[model samples]
Target: MITSPDNDNNRDEPMVFIVIAKAYETEGGQPIDLHVMLTAPDDDTAVRLTLNALSEEGFLEADLDQIGMITGAPDEEPHASAYQGALEGEVAIIRFA
Candidate 1:
């Protein structure tokens, strides 16, 4: 979990963010998808933290840009399958009604 510092008047509670990384195998160019959960104060911070974490783990940023989605509420479980194969590959924060 990564978070900005809390100030006297603002308390930033941790929120769950889903991260999907498109990783390729070193041997045959096979693609392995990764679905992960990250905790942060907000969606933007979540993406930044996720990118940092992935980079530390040796995943390239270009490969990572393939898929990134923030799903579920702070108390809800994320459904990773629902957003698979998304073409746009844009950053999204989705909440159920």
Candidate 2:
């Protein structure tokens, strides 16, 4: 799990978010999905970061139109399972002081 820097003095730092997106491969292929946990000052920043990462990895902007959900920091219990199994990808969490 990648994590952003922590500044104890800053109380207004951005919270982390879990971004889940799914889109069909090509025009009729099977659906592809991604689960990423990232930190940003807000939802918009998180989405932008996710998009940039995806694009860097060859995912087109047109293919990302089918976002399933963008949720704020989830509780620990449910997220614990995400850490298990094979790792798909990882991103450092960003925190602003």
Candidate 3:
């Protein structure tokens, strides 16, 4: 499990977050759907980590729509894979082309 560098939540387990966002790769360009899944100690940390990850992934700007916590791993494709990746300390992103 991965937590933000500044996270102070002392929980032993990481909380899974699913963030829905619209991102732009270029100025004035069309928006892209960027859904992310990751583990963090808290909601604030999760948002921060997601923003940083988006920047690192080359997104110029992003507008987050929602952030939800997952009580259990998903049983579907894509989401299931993303959830597993989050457990292994990765910021898993799902994109639709």
The predicted structure with the larger TM-score, 1 or 3, is 3
Q: Per-candidate TM vs. native?
A: 0.44, 0.47, 0.85
Higher-lDDT candidate among 1 and 2?
2
Among these predictions, the greatest TM-score belongs to: 3
Put down candidate 3 lDDT per residue, 1-97, tens digits, no spaces. 6565756645566789999999999999999997899998888999999999999999999999999998888899899999999999999999977
- In model 2, the worst 10-residue window by lDDT is 85-94
Candidate models: Cα lDDT each: 0.48, 0.50, 0.92
Q: What is the C-alpha RMSD of each candidate to the true structure, in Å?
A: 10.9, 10.7, 6.5
Once fitted onto the true fold, the runs of candidate 2 whose alpha carbons sit more than 4 angstroms away are 1-14, 23-28, 61-97
- Model 1 is weakest, by summed lDDT over 10 consecutive residues, at 82-91
Clash-forming residue pairs, model 3? none
Q: Give the TM-score of candidate 3.
A: 0.85
Better of 1 and 3 by lDDT: 3
Report the lDDT tens digits of candidate 1 across residue range 1-97. 7586657746443344566566543544655566656555666776676566655665554244432434443333344432331212333332222
